[model samples]
Target chain A: MSAFYSVLKRELRSYFASPLAYIILVVFQVISARFFFLYLQGFLQFQLDPSYQLQTGDLNLNNLVILPYFGTISIVLLLIVPLITMRLIADEKKNYTAELLFTSPIHIRTIVLGKFAAALILLIMMLLLSSVNVFVLMVHGNPDLGAVLSGYTGLFLLGASFLSIGIFASSLTDNQLIAAVISFGVLLVLWLVGALSDAESSILGYLSVINHYEDFGKGIVDLKDVVYYVSLIFLGLFLTYSALESERWR
Target chain B: MVYVHNLTKRYGNLTAVENLSFQLERGDVLGFLGPNGAGKTTTMRIITGYMPPTKGTVHIEGVDIFDEPLQAKRVIGYLPENPPLYNDMTVMEYLSFVADIKKVGRKEKKSRIFYVMERCGIAEVRRRIIGHLSKGYRQRVGIAQALVNNPSVLILDEPTIGLDPRQIIEIRELIKSLSGDRTVILSTHILPEVTMICSKVIIINHGKIVLEESLQKLSEDMRSAESILLRTRQNGEGVVEKIHALGNVSSVKPGAAGEYIIVPRKGAEVREELSRLAVENDWGLLELRPVTNTLEEVFLKVISSEGN
Candidate 1:
């Protein structure tokens, strides 16, 4: 347990020691905040226009602003999470620090778990920073608090899944850029796989990472959606562990 | 104590280490000598539990590394060819991190870090970032990190490769001082380092150990008067035949600059007779020296013999 915490602490410290983490946080906040304001503007425009208001009798702030805001930010996270996770294991290999970790009296599972936990914590912090925009709606307007909480939950799961994929990709290569590119490609494919089929029961729809996330946007924390995201996280980390283990044999 | 039995590692069809076996009692410092691509690093990695061999078992302090790597690794410290360092971390932070992973007690961690820093002579730069330190300092930090756990077995691969002459001597002296109770297996391209630090030497060639012997025995065998060099002032016509005719000298080959290489019979002492012969022929004996086989020559000889 101490070994696991040590790795986690070192990884978090490493993230803060570099300029990349701060740059990522600032960039994510700026871009997500911009998208939030755009959604708020659209909601305001709909409230002022009589024809629009007549077509949709009541404009729920949760549906008008928060749902779309979370939706666009999920896409932004898809683009940004790779940057956060690319160097987790890749830099270790590049600098030969992986040797230090592997030779130490710690299990591979412990190292992987520690690194995953650190990245998840950073992702959570990123989400919390982005949520300040949603808090504005809650302050001045009456947005469904339950829906906003569920939306945040869904965003956390989605980001966690993306980060798992990124760490797995990072484990496959020592080059951080290649790790980032591979993870981005994998995340993009999983996000679009659901588009291949209209029926939600289809295997493609079931496999799409983003499809499971829609329930969270609607303020629904479906057990099925949670299970899917959790399973994806497990699969990604399992693959990473297998990759690291096989590296010894090779 | 450490024992490696029939260790073999194959990557696809290429074998990096083949049927290698050796043993070390407590306090033994083994010198691992080999040319490039000789599988020294591969063997070290396996013993340190960094990598699993395709066929073999390594036991450190009676713990089978393959069966329980964590238990085995807890007693081992390794410094790879390239020092594993986090560039952004300060020396103190890096050592603290190592101490944490190695599971040093919370109270002992601080003192252990300070002890290693002091031993490796990096205490003055403990607060400096690892990346900003010089290469010599970085290597010292590497050694310090390896020692933070106070491991029983220390495996160092090319620890002195990139250091200056002074730094190499300092590191060698430090290693020498470190070897009383701790077992050390150090691999190096420098032959003299083996003579200076190792009690036993293992020379590997093509994934196999070609020679393993104690330093005292190896030097003894090397010093047994197999040949001698005789340098005289004149061109020394017929000196080879004359020296060979002296009975104890088996054969003499004339060399450049009026020199003759005399090979003597086993246990022969021909120096006195050679001097007499040179004086009788009025050949001014400029130099007479016994040719001792250096570790370099023995290493090359063993490697070449293994190659054939």
Candidate 2:
């Protein structure tokens, strides 16, 4: 436990020491805030236009401003998660510090978990920082609190899954660019896999992480969706552990 | 405290180490001597449980390294050719992390880190980032990290490479001061450090152990009466005949600078006899010295002899 904590602490410090972390935060805030403002503007225009509103009067602010905001941020996270984690293990290998971590008594699982946890914590912080948009929704209009809460929950889980993929990719190489590219490719596949599934019972739809994330965008926290994200996170981390172990053997 | 048997490592068709075996007891500071690409680093990594050998067994104390790596690694502190430092971390934080991973208890962690820092002479830079420190200071921090967890065995591979002479001496002295009941294995291609610090030496070339001998015995064997140089003021009368007549002198030839290059018999004390012969004949004895073989020559001889 102490080993896990120490590695976690060091990893977080490294993230803060580099400008990349701050840059990612600013990027996320700017993009998500832009989407939120656009949705709010569209909602106001919808209310003012009698013809446009008579056609579709069922539009709500929670759906208009908050749900799409969370959904858009999740897509942005697909890009940001890779940048955040591309160097976690890959840089360690490049710098030869993996030798230190490997030779230490800490288990490979602990090392992987420490790095993943640290990155996930940063991702969570970035997600929370964008809640200013949510508070803005709260100040001006009545928003669905349950939907907002579930949306944040889904965003955290989705980010965890993306981070796991990044962690696995980082373990496969010593180059950060390759890790980032590989992670983005994997996440894009996960995001697009649902389109090929035309049936509700199809395994492809069940496996599509983006599919599970949609319920959270609708303010519904299904136990199955939570379980899917948790299991995917586990599988990704397990693959990372195996990747590190195989590297030692090679 | 360390035993390796028939260790072999093969990377596809290339064999990095082959059938190499050695053992060290408590307080024995063994020097692992080898040239570049002699598999020193591979062997060290295997013993440290960072990599597995193709065929071998390494026992630390009594535990097999491959079978019980975590348990074995708990007792070994390894410093590779390049120190594995987190550049963003201060020395104090790095050492603390090392201590934690090495399983030092919370109650003992602070004192243990402090003791290692003081011993390694890195206490003053404990608060500075490792990347910002001088190379020598970073190397000392590397040693400090190895010592932080109070492991029973220490493995330092080429610890003094790329240091100024003054820093090398300081590190050498530091390593010497560290010797006690703890086992230390320091590897280097440089020969002088072996003679200066190690009690036992293992010379490996081409993935094989060419020689393994104590420093005293090797030094003694290296200092035999094979060749000598002599010079005298009176070079003419009866001097050559009298010196030649000595049973120890096999052949004598005039060398440059009015000196004699004398070869000795199988086992002889030519220095004492030649000095006496010069004095008895009133030939001024300007210089009498044995020409010992250099370590480079010895390594060449050993490798060639093994090759043939």
Candidate 3:
């Protein structure tokens, strides 16, 4: 466990030592803030009463108020998580530092998990910063804490899954750009799978990330959705570990 | 002690190392001599448990490296051909991280980092970011990370590659000073370094051990057939013929400036006889010095023979 933490700390330090973490945070915050103000302007122009409670309008005023915020947060995270993870293993391999980690007494799983944990911590920090938009919504009107917490929960899981996928992709090559491109491509496919599938082809829909995320966005915590996201994270992380292990043989 | 038995590593159809086997005793500095792409790095990687051999076994302190890699790896420290460094990190941070990965106790980690830094002469650069340091200091930090855990065996692959002459000497001296207490296996194409620091030299060629012998025995067994440079005032006068007639002298040829080079049969030293011949001929002998074979020559001979 200490070994895991040490690797985690080293990875976090690496992130902060470069311009990457700060860049990702600033870009994400700026985009989320922009999206929030745009949504606020639309809300004000529509003259939606702050006291207008939605029992079920065509667009629930409450959903209108929070859904764009969730959308903005998700889009920003989808782009940023890959950037954070693109260099995790690819740069290490390029620098030949993977040999140091592999030869050490630490297990391969710990090294992969540690790097993922570090990236997850950073993603969570960004998610928290994005939540300031939610707090802004709260000041203007009543925002459902339960719905917001569920939304944040979904964002965390989605970011973690993207991070694991990025790590797996990074493990495949020494070129960070290739890793980023491949990770983004994979995430995009997973995100759009549901949109491409109909209810008759719902099995494939389960593979879509948005299918699971929708439940969280709608303030519903389904055990199956949690299991799916957890499995996705594990699957990506497992592939990454296996990829790293095979490098020695190569 | 370390033992390797018929260690072979193959990538698909390409064999990087083939049927290689050698042993090292405690406190022995074994120099791995080979040209580029001669499997020196592959062998070291396998021995250090960074990679498993496709067809053989490596035992570090009797623990099979592939079977119990954690335990086996705990006994060995490896510095790959390129020093594995996180460039963003400071020397102290890198060493501390290595210590953590190597499972050094927290209480002892600081002291271990300090000790290795002092040993590698990078104590003053501990706070500098590794990327900002000079190549020599970066190499020292690499060595420091390898030595942080104080493992029983140290495996360094091209530890002095790319360093300036002064840095090379410093690293060589540091490696030499590490000899008495731990087993060290260093690989290099620099033959003179082997002669200088290694008690035993294992010359590899084309992924095979061409020569594995103690430095003393290798030099003794491959000693140049005795040859002496003889400078005398008496120009010719059949001096070459007269020297060749001596029992131990096999041949003699005229050299530059009224000098003759006398060659003796194997294990024969004809300097004394040649001196007597020159003195009896009333020739003023200017010089009589034996020509010895250097490690470079021996290395070339061994490697060239393998090429054939």
Candidate 4:
């Protein structure tokens, strides 16, 4: 555990020591804020009926405004989380510092977990910054706090899943650019799987990231959705650990 | 103490190290002399538990590196050919991180880092970013990281490869002082470095140990078969004929400008006889000195023997 913490601390420090964290946070904030404001403009311009919402309908003008805002925020996070994690392992290998970590007494799991935790922390920080959009909604009009909390929870799980894939991709190569491209490509495929196959295809919907996220986005805390995200995260981490173990043999 | 028994590493079909075996007692400074691609680095990596050998085993203090890596690794510190450094980090930060990973106790981490910094002569540059430091300082940081845990065994792969002459001397002194308490394996093809700092030398070629002997003993053995350079005022014909006729002189060849190099039979010292012959022939003896083999010759001899 201490080894894990040590790696986490060093990785986090490394993130802040460069322009990476700041760039990630700034870009996330700009895109998410722009999406939120555009959603607000669309809400006002359409002036749609306030009480004609979907299945979990406690229809209010605020839910109508905030749901699309949170949706856009999730999209923006999906794009930015990979950027932060793609360099985690790939850059370490490129710089040859992976040898230092591998030769240390610490286990490979500890190193992977540490990097995962650091990327998670950075994503959480950016998510927290994006929550200001929620606060702005609260100040202007009444909004459902439960729905807003669920939206953030959904964002966190999505980010975690994206980060896991990014780390796995990073482990596949020593080039950060290639890792980023591959991770983004993987996430895009996962996001689009549902569209390529009908909802009747259970496996396709099961594999789609959007299918799992839809429950949380609707402010529904479905046990199956949570399990799916957790399973994806675990699978990605398992592949990352295997990748590092195989590197020693190479 | 360190023991390697029949260690071999193969990447696909190419064998990096094959049937190599040697022992290192405590306080022994062993030099690993090998040409490029001779598996010096691969052997060190295996012994350090960075990579497991495809065959055989490595034991440090009676603990097998593969079976008990943490225990075996706790006793060994390794500096690879290129120092693994985080360029974004300051020297002090990098050392601290190494201390943490090496599992140094929190209370002693600062003092240990400082001690290693002072020992490697990088204390003054402790706060400088590692990427901005000079090559010598970077090398010192590498050594300092390896020494931070105070392991009983130190494995250095060409620690002086890219340093200037002054830095090389300083690093050699530093490594020399590091001996007597730690079993250090200094790997290099730099012949002079082996003679200066290593007590025992292992010369490897074509993935096998061709020669492993104490530096002093190897030189002493070669000294008995030494050649003598004799410079005389006489022309080439007179010098060669006179030296060749001397007792115990096996062969004599005329060198540049009337000089002659005489090779005596094994265990023979024909210097006095050659001197007397020069006097008898009225050839003025300008210089007569026994040729002692430097480590360079020993290395070349070992490598060439392996080639044959």
Q: State the lDDT of candidate 3 residue by residue for A1-250, as single tens digits.
A: 2889999999999999999999989999998888888887777766666454543454543577677788878877777777998999999989999889889988999999999999999998898888887787778687678888898899899889999999999999999999999999999989888887788248878889888888798788899889999999999999998887877777
On residues B149-175, what C-alpha lDDT tens digit does candidate 1 reach at each position? 998999999999889999999999999
Local lDDT at B123 for model 3: 92
Flag regions of model 2 displaced more than 4 Å.
A51-57, A196-204, B233-241, B250-254, B263-267, B279-284
lDDT of each: 0.92, 0.88, 0.87, 0.86
Interface RMSD, one decimal, each candidate: 1.3, 1.3, 1.5, 1.7
TM-score of 1: 0.95
Docking model 3 quality class = medium
DockQ of each candidate, alpha-carbon based: 0.77, 0.73, 0.77, 0.64
- Model 2 earns a TM-score of 0.94
Best by lDDT: 1
Strongest candidate by DockQ: 3
DockQ of 4: 0.64
> Which residue pairs in candidate 2 collide?
none
lDDT of 2 by residue, B50-150 (tens): 98899989999889998888888898888888999989889998998888889988999999999988888889989999989998888888888888878
